[model samples]
Target: MEYIYASLLLHAAKKDINEDALKNVLSAAGIEVDEVRLKAVAAALKEVNIDEVLKSAATAPVAVAAVPA
Candidate 1:
């Protein structure tokens, strides 16, 4: 979702993921910010460790299916 991506952008930029900051980022991207979603995102990520989640996601294995030759 755009909201999640916006938060990721903020995390990558080393910026705080607060409602105001998220709103600014979304506005810059020309996406309308939803007040409810913004509040939910800020609350959801309040105690998350972005770095840890990224590391786990990066190292997580993907299932690839082989096609018949």
Candidate 2:
């Protein structure tokens, strides 16, 4: 998947999303995208199902909160 698409998917997942962070991640991945394009990509992502993307991203390891005594 394109970096922007992946970023948008991550954003849709509501995982503390940020455009600049997405842009940086994409840049690190060797994908160069302009802000205008990024906005368009974000807009396009709004049509996608957020839950599915979140479920997919959830496959990765994450830290869960511990219950307090």
lDDT of 2 by residue, 1-69 (tens): 575566665665665345666677678778876787777666666576666966878986766869798
Best-fitting candidate, scored by TM-score: 1
The TM-scores, one per candidate, come to 0.86, 0.46
lDDT of 1 by residue, 1-69 (tens): 898899999998999999999999999999988899999999999888888998998888966768779
RMSD of each: 2.5, 10.1
Candidate 1 has an lDDT of 0.92
User: Which structure among the candidates has the greatest lDDT?
Assistant: 1
